[model samples]
Target: MIETDKNQILLNMMTDYAKNNPDTIFCYTNAAILYETPRWEELPLEIHTVQSNKKIKNRTAITHIRPYFKKSKYKGFNVITLVDLLLELAVNDTEISAISSISHHLYKNEISVETILNYCQSQKQKSGVAKLRHLVSFASRLDESPFETKVRLKLYVAGVIIPVQQHQVICQNKKKYRVDFLFEFKGRKIILEADGLIKYSSNVNERANERQRESDLIREGYEIMRVMNHDFENGRFAQILENYGIPKRRYYGKKIVKKHY
Candidate 1:
């Protein structure tokens, strides 16, 4: 029953915030009051003053002073921009300059606008860019995209020097296209594209464009290796290893999980 209450609280926060600000994105952290009990809700209103541990913070008054409270059917939290949240929080009494300053400060620390929005809607009072940075670090570890994360992890684990992502590729025609990952050795370029086949297919016009792009890339002598979601997931690492000519032990055929700290 206690767990159910927390879920209700979180749901309320998320639904209220979303309806009040339809343009704003809602994330779990935005409705994080449900993570702890009412007794632990009061953890110094200011984010800087708030303790890192959940069991230590007291955040009861958070529900009372929620910035958005028109309705009470919060389905879940979402991702939104900092600028939007600031506007929503302030409502008609918008503080433009102050919010811009805060947004600028957060962006400087590599905190995206989405991170700032989540922090603002959270229980912590006086939340700022600094605390937003901390939240971003915590959230990255909890990213939902498992396949992309694991591929990067597998490359790192096998001691392979993976190239930087979104690197630009210049073709013979002087046109450039950025790729997911690029590894340049001597004159040969090994391109690895992490293909998320959600909105793409071979029968569509987009596929035609993709074919042209690949043709142009191949014409430029790029040794491309398109790694799809299935490759890492369906136990096909051996095929990749052989294609890349990276000699592997018999253990390479087995599933490899990254044991990150």
Candidate 2:
């Protein structure tokens, strides 16, 4: 078989994969993440394409030639380029044309902003979507984590702009504890700690660790709010914020669709 024929065989595989897992976020930088993205796995899928490193107009295009394939604008309306499809999968705003252009690399298939949005809405309704919604809820409370990526998701929903993570703090003895979230408002240091100590062995050890951490923080004259895993999971995060003296903001009491087993 010729190389062209081999390439055709591969593209067909990718098309089949996409049809089955339409919501997976595909990107050049994160091939593994894309492949393992929810609902893509456990369904048995594969991607078929020609492997080439041709730089067209100073941009590297993953080139392929398949007769039956999805077409898009970025690939000149015949068949969608990998980049074009990636951009379509990454679509963000339906109302703003300017923002949609960011994903224009996948726009070649002539995928309209509306179509991208409809696909997104449908993707959000898939079986695991509820679990993902819970995950998004979990992620919103912090900006960064060695704990979990929950922080970024939490802030996004709460409309709380996240402070830089791992900001160092020195206690009176000069010992340091890197804080999870910190915000400076009205010259006060609002320190938020995602209490992930339960994963540590022994309830005794966990309590001791938290006590030491809190003592060290308090000694530094910083008011700290420690949030348990359950608070975020149960929609009690806003109350946790209030207990930390966040002054009852609007998003503090927002209700989320939480799934309970």
Candidate 3:
């Protein structure tokens, strides 16, 4: 789990940057957070300005607004809109899955996919336009988490049949449980859950209830596979997938994206 201090850390960074560069606009994740609380991971501060003299120092990214964007003339310290941030993510070659998750959050709430697409389409000379379109191709409002998106990408890359996400299952006892992902293969019912640190606590009763819930699903013949958030590290994540007999496959996407986190 991210510490509450992360919000303060981001604020401090923005405050320090805005102090010296008054004309510069806090864009990217900084702008996104100004509009709404963060949904995924925290990122470094990004700023944009019409001035070309201000060079980006360590830990901060800088973009210069060209004449076309300058004509629009965004006002205030947070001049970049969500659409601008989306375009910046595209131009910056952000990791594909992270981009998808961010796109999901923005489009599902305050923006439309078409509005983003239309913006991209109109920006013929924009650096990240094509890249943004590729990233958005994988985006949907159904996104739940960055971890889930990573799981989906891993499944896609490994040539495995992607499990049904947010699947509903009814036990014989008349209780209904919503699962993260469900996979059915060769008469076997598999329930895959990705658990973050937020799921675990020191409370004994909570753990007891979790065990009981699993027992109920087990009694109904549904096999449970719980994946901790950290399990995605090292080779452990790949091993878990192979253990489930998901066949390995080659990746087909053209973009070469490295994770920002």
Stretch of 10 with least lDDT, candidate 2: 92-101
lDDT of 2 by residue, 1-261 (tens): 555454354445445554554433333222323333222122222231221122224322232223334533222213454333433322321211212222221223423434444444566644443333332222222232223344434554566644556578888787878887777666678787766544456788887987898888877777887666577776688666656655423454433333350
lDDT of 3 by residue, 1-261 (tens): 355465455456555655666544333333443434443334232232222233445423333222224433422233345677666555543355336545455534756778878988898687767767667766656556555566666566656676788888888889888887888888888888877556568899999988888999999888888787678689787788878775443555543353431
User: How accurate locally, in lDDT, is each candidate?
Assistant: 0.45, 0.44, 0.59
- When 1 and 2 are scored with lDDT, the better candidate is 1
Comparing 2 and 3 by lDDT, which wins? 3
Where model 2 places Cα greater than 4 Å from the true spot, the runs are 1-147, 203-207, 247-261
Number of the top TM-score candidate: 3
lDDT of 1 by residue, 111-162 (tens): 4656555665563555343333332332222222323444554565565554
The residue ranges of model 1 lying beyond 4 angstroms of the native Cα positions read 1-147, 199-203, 246-261
2 or 3: which has the higher TM-score? 3
Per-residue error for 44 in candidate 3, Å, reads: 21
Estimated TM-score per prediction? 0.44, 0.39, 0.67
Residue 89 shift from truth in candidate 2, angstroms: 9.2
RMSD to true structure for each model, in Å = 14.4, 14.2, 7.7
Better of 1 and 2 by TM-score: 1
